[model samples]
Target: MSDIAAPRSSSRARNLKGGGRNRSGQTNFELYSWLFMRLSGLALVVLVLGHLFTNLMLGDGINGLDFAFVAGKWASPLWQVWDLLMLWLAMLHGTNGMRTIINDYAEKDQTRFWLKALLLTASIVIVVLGTLVIFTFDPCLDPHSTLSVCQ
Candidate 1:
């Protein structure tokens, strides 16, 4: 063996200068976040595929899409729930990914904090608005409506 001692292990090297173990008392938030990203990503794939197939492959296809088409689709509670889940999951999944990016690239604590705050605010607003639109959509908003649902 050489006279020089081997380098310290990474975990030991990160210890406090006073030889004390550096325990930050942090919880498993990162672990849960990672798990959520994976689960939501899988869920989003299924949801998006279902949504695309339903909207594009069924009925008259893309040519049939219009305000009336949307009205008909949203009239069903099943479609409403499907779209709502898609909206929420997509927003949350995207937000989580952005949060990870912010944590990785943002150098200053204040910048990170503000970026996260903005992200949260924007996400909440989008989710709330999307949910409201999905649930409270008025398909018969037109004053002159002869559609069966309007009757």
Candidate 2:
């Protein structure tokens, strides 16, 4: 290997001198997003693994998962809150992650805006629906329904 090897250079290496505000006028939003990604990713690992373990390991495992089974779990406040927390955290984390990816790759402003708009819509829809399912679920509904635990 040569002593210098032509020296390495990248966008971050060159400081933007008088470029506007960032030296290159780069907004701190990207930096904040990067930090959020790391923190959220770490949390997601724990939340997801715990979820999988509880739902697929303890007792009958995956074989036990079903509509009635879900209703029974949701009948308890603990599982309800647990699932609510999991839903919100994972949704926000995933949305922010996708935002980062979009910002990093999208070239045009309109393209970036549209992609983010779609991501936000989908995230919000899922989060709201998931939260509703966790909270408004009536385990006692339909006494004759075979699928309901209340039956």
**Candidate achieving the largest lDDT:** 1
TM-score of each: 0.78, 0.71
Across 18-130, the per-residue lDDT of candidate 2 in tens digits comes to 33336554766667767877887788788789889988999799899977788877878887877887788788878997988998999999999999999999999999999
What is the Cα-based lDDT of residue 92 in candidate 1? 88
lDDT of 1 by residue, 47-127 (tens): 999989988999888999998899998988888888998999899899999999999999999999999999999999999
Reference-based lDDT, each prediction: 0.87, 0.79
Candidate 1 lDDT score at position 41: 91
Question: Each prediction's Cα RMSD?
Answer: 9.3, 10.9
The list of candidate 1 runs beyond 4 A from truth reads 1-24
lDDT against true structure, model 1: 0.87
Error of 1 at 113 (Å): 1.7
